[model samples]
Target: MQFLYGVQLLIMILMPLIQMVMKAIGIGFVSYLGSNLIIDQAMNYIVSQMSGAGAVVQQILGLAKIDVAINIYFSAITTRMVLSGLNKLQDRKRAQVWRAPGGTSIEA
Candidate 1:
């Protein structure tokens, strides 16, 4: 019916837009968590462990004086992971279909 066709057309038009929005939201959320939660937890753990190293090591190496940039490091790692996953998914979705000699179709 015309109603069914209209509904299908609407879905076809909106599906890609919806998927793009979801992907963007997912990436942004991951970046936020990586920059905030992961970095904070890592910094806290490092500080606790460093504090336990005693005054002798602290005075010798000056660990307290050195600043650790965990946000930058963790952000780079999270970006690389998300990009790699997205690339793999894209490649899978665009995989090539070929016909074999036996007249069977295969996706590679």
Candidate 2:
């Protein structure tokens, strides 16, 4: 029990650091993608090819003569990546708890 507590304490201490590193990586990735002209053009082409709400959004921005910054798209992608990472981390914790010795399995 003491060993388990120690491990838990260590994880608690490291979690924030892990999240901070992830955020930093996400920001760096977005910046890199935004700064590359080829990637930027590719992304614009992809967005323009998109249908439904994407089309409407593109039309709106075009009509308004607003050149949406690349950061807008990249920031959204970064946010999604971070959220997905957090969800996976939580899922792993839940799996550990559910699969621990003598722990009851949850059925869907």
Candidate 3:
């Protein structure tokens, strides 16, 4: 019937657009998981640990009457190192693909 043909034509026309939207949503969900679940938690833990270490160093310098400016320098260096490490980690995660023992690829 003409109605059946029209329905088929409409579905054919819409399929690609539907697929494109689904792909975009999948990508966005993965990005959200990577940033919110992984990176943010790791950054928080790193910053907290670094701050504790910096505090200890500050105390030692304070006792020695050394200028506290050195603490600032060390903090800057530590931050850069942490950022570089996190960037490498992010890149590695992005590049990695998981596979099963049976040679099947797993997708995110």
lDDT of 3 by residue, 4-102 (tens): 999999999999999999998997688657655654565567556645667778577568655455446455756776688689778987954656655
| Candidate 1 lDDT tens digits, 1-108 | 999999999999999999999999998788678667866788788767877877898675464454344546666877887788789879988957655655465545
TM-scores, in order shown? Answer: 0.45, 0.35, 0.42
The lDDT, on a scale of 0 to 1, for candidate 1 is 0.76
Cα displacement (angstroms), candidate 1, residue 48, comes to: 0.7
Candidate-wise lDDT, in order: 0.76, 0.71, 0.70
Query: Candidate 2: where are CA atoms >4 Å away?
Result: 38-108
> Candidate 2: lDDT of 87?
97
In terms of lDDT, the best-performing candidate is: 1
| Candidate 1 residue spans exceeding 4 A from truth | 53-108
